[model samples]
Target: MQSVERTFELLELMADSGGEVALSDLAEQSGLPLPTIHRIIRTLVNNGYARQQPSRRYALGPRLIRLGETASRALGSWARPYLAELTEITGESANMAVLDGEQIVYVAQAPSPHSMRMFTEVGRRVDAHATAVGKAVLATMPADEVAQLLARTPMSPKTENTITTIESMHEELERIRARGYSIDDGEQEVGVRCFAVAVPGAPAGAAISISGPEARMTRISTDEVIPLMQRLASSLSAELSASA
Candidate 1:
C-alpha cells in the first residue's frame, strides 16, 4: 500500500512539473530516495505508463491518455446531476469545466429550458482569460502559477469586454478572490453573461457556472445568484472530495 501510494505520488509530482521531470527532480520534489523513484519509474515505464524522453527526462506516456479520457467521462457523469440541479435553480445553462493545461475544457453541462439560452458543448475547450469558469479556476491558483499559465496562452479578445492584458487579468482575479466568485459580463460573447465559482477540494482545478442571455440574466439579482452558486459549488466540492 505504501509503495502504491509513493508510486502515485511520484506520478502526481511529475504531472505537477508539467508532465515531465528528471529522476533527481522527482526525488527532490517527492522527498523519496533516488533509488526508490528510479525503481518505481522503471516499473511505470515498463508498463507503458511513463516514457523516457530523448532528453532523458521522464514524461507521462501515451497509455495514460485512455485512462485520462475515461476519468474525464466519469467526472462528467458525476457532475451532471449537480449541474442539472443548478440549472433548475437558476433557470440558466449550467456548466462544469476543468483546467487542462492553459485551457478550460467543458466536461458537463445542463442546458436551460429557455428557447434562447446559452449552450456550450461538452468537451469544448476555450481560453481561460475569456470565460468565467476559467477565471474562477485561476483565482484558486497562486499568482505566480497563474502568471505562468497566462503567459503561455494568447489572451485574444473574444469580445470587446474580454480582458486582453495580464495586468487587467490580475485585477480581475483579485476581484474574483474578494467576491468569492467570478463573472463574465459578455466577455466571451456579446449578449451573454456567466457567473462561476471554483469547486473547493477538487482533485483538479475545477469550476461550475451558470450562463444565459444578458437581458434575462440581469433580471436576476447577483445577490441571489452568487450565494446559490456558492452553495451548489460547496456541495459539489464535498461530493468530489469524498469520492476522491
Candidate 2:
C-alpha cells in the first residue's frame, strides 16, 4: 500500500513537471529516499507507465496517453446527463470543457431546444481568452500562472467585446472570482451570451457553461441561471470525483 501511494505521488510529481523529471529532482520533490524512488520508478518503467528520456530524466510513457484519452472520453459521457439537465432548465445550449495546454476543449454539449441556438461541436478547441468556460477555468488558477499562460497565447479578438489585453483579462478574472461565475458578453460571437461556473472538485481546469442569444439570456434570467449552473457544476464535480 505504501509503495503504491509513493508510486502515484511520483507520477503526479512528474506530471506537474510537464511529464518529465530528473531522479534527483523527484527525490527532492517527493521527500523519498533514492532507493525507494528508484525502485518505484523502475517498476513504473517496466510496466510502461514511465520511460527514461535521452537526457536520462524520466517521463510519462506513451501507454498512459491511451489511458488518459479513454478516461477523458468516459468523463464526457458521465457528464452528459448533467449538461442535458442544464440545457433543459435554462433553455440554452450547455457545454463542458477542460483547459488543455493553451486552449479550452469542449468535451460534451447538450443543444438548446430553440429553433435558433448556439452550437459548438464536441472536441472543438478555442482560445481561453474568448469564452465563458475558458474564463471559468482560468479563474480557478493562480494569477501568476495565468499570466504566464496568457503571455504565450495571443488574445486575438473574436468579437469586439472579446478581452484583448492582459490587464483587462486580469480585472475580468477578479470579477469572476468575486461573482462565482463568468460571462461571455458577445465575446466569442455576436448576439450570443454565455454564463459559466467552474466545477469545484472536478479534475484539472473543468467548467460548465450555458449559451444562447443575448435577448433570451438576459440579466433578468441570470439570477435563476447562475445558481442552477452552480448546483449542476457541484453535482457534476461529485460524480467526477467518485469516478476518479
Candidate 3:
C-alpha cells in the first residue's frame, strides 16, 4: 500500500512539472531517495504508464490517454444531475468544464427551457481566458502558474470584451477570487453572459456555470446567482470526492 501511494505521488509530481521530470528532480520534489524513485519510475516505464524522453527525462506515456478519456466521460455522466438541477433553478443553461492541458473542455451541459438560450456543445474546447468556467478554474491556480499557462497560449479575442493582456487577466482573476465567482460579460461571445464558480476540492481543475443571453442574464442578481452557483459547486464537489 505504501509503495502504491509512493508511485501515485511520483506520477502526480511528474504531471505537476508539466508532464515530465528528471529522476533527480523527482527525488528532490518527492523527498524520496534517488534509488526508490528510479525503481518506481522503471516500473512505470515498463508498464507503459510513463516513458523516457530522448532527453532522458520521464514523461507521462500514451496509455494514460485512454484512462483520461474514460474518466472524463464518467465524470460528465456523474455531473449531469447536478447540472440539471442548476438549469432548473436558474432557468438558464448550465455547464461543467475541466481544464485540459492549456484549454477548457466542456464535459456536460443541461439546456434551458426557454426558446432563446445559450448552448455550448459538449467536448468543445476553448481558451481558458475567454469563458466564465475557464476563469473560475484559473482563479484557483497560483499566479505564476496561471501566467505560465497564459504565456503558452495566445489570448486571442473571442469578442470585444475578451481580456487580451496578461496584466488585465490577472486583475480579473483577482476580482474573481475576491468575489468567489467569475463573470463572462460578452467576453466569450457577444450577447452572452455567464457566471461560474470552481468546484471545491476537485481532483482536477473543474467549474460549473450558468449562462444566457445578456438581456436575461443581466436581470439575474449576482447576490442570488453567485450563492446558488457556489452551493451547487460545493454539493457537486462533495459527490466527486466521495466517488473518488
Candidate 4:
C-alpha cells in the first residue's frame, strides 16, 4: 500500500479502539514490525495526533477531536443548505442521511411546519430498511453490495409497513429506479410518509429525503414528488460535484 494509505490504516485502527492501542497489537493488526510501528506512532504523538497511555497503549490525542469536529462542521454546513431547500420546496420535513455501515446516520434535519410529524434526531442511527433516505442511497449501490448488507443485517420488520425480506427490498429498489425516487409509505413509523432521491456521487453512503404526515404527503404522489426530487438531486449533484 502507499505510505499515506498505510498511515491512515494505522490511524483508523487507533481510532476504532477509542484512541488507545497496544504497540504489539498495532503491529499485529497493521502487519508491520513493532519497531516500525513504534517509530510511526512516535511521529504521530509528536505531531499531537496521538498519544500513549500509562499502560503503554497509544490513543488518539486531543488534537484529533478538534480536527474531527472541524470536518463534521464543514460537512454539515455543506448539507444544511440542500436540506433547507428540500424542506422549503416540499413544505415538510427534510433530512440528509449518510450510511454508516448498515445503518443510516442523520447529519442534518428540518422539521415540518405542522405540529404532528415524525422527526428524526440529528446524529441518530436507524435501520436502513425503515427510512426513505436509506432506500434511495441503497439503490445507487451495485446489486452485490445491497445483497451483502441485507445478509449481514437481516431485515427486521420495523412496522407493519416495513419490508422484511431481501427479495422485497430488491423489488423496492427496482421500483425506486423505475420511478426515479423512493417512497417511505409509513414503513419506519406509522402515519408518516416520505419521498427520497439519491444524492449523486456521494461517497457511497448518502441520500436525501422529504417527509411529512401521511395526510399531507398523500397529496403529493409519486408523479409530483419524483420530478421535484429529481430536480433537487440534480442541483445537489452539481453542487457536490463542483465542490469535489
List the pairs of residues colliding in candidate 3: none
Global Cα RMSD, each model: 2.3, 3.2, 2.2, 4.9
Worst 10 residues of 3 by lDDT: 12-21
The per-residue C-alpha lDDT of model 2 at residue 166 equals 91
**lDDT of every predicted structure (CA atoms):** 0.91, 0.89, 0.92, 0.80
**Clash list (residue pairs), candidate 2:** none
If scored against the real structure, what TM-score would every candidate get?
Answer: 0.87, 0.79, 0.88, 0.74
How many backbone overlaps does candidate 4 show? 2
Candidate whose lDDT is highest: 3
Local accuracy of candidate 3 as per-residue lDDT tens digits, 115-190: 9999899989999999999999999999998998898789999999999999999999999999999999999999
Better of 3 and 4 by lDDT: 3
In terms of TM-score, which candidate is stronger, 1 or 4? 1
Worst 10 residues of 1 by lDDT: 11-20
Please write out the lDDT profile of model 1 over residues 40-147, one tens digit for every residue.
999999999999999999999889978877877888888899899989988999999998767888999999999999989998999999999999999999999889
Worst 10 residues of 4 by lDDT: 68-77
Q: Show model 2 residue runs off by greater than 4 Å.
A: 100-103, 144-168, 186-191, 213-220, 241-244
Q: In angstroms, give how far residue 201 of model 1 lies from its true place.
A: 1.3
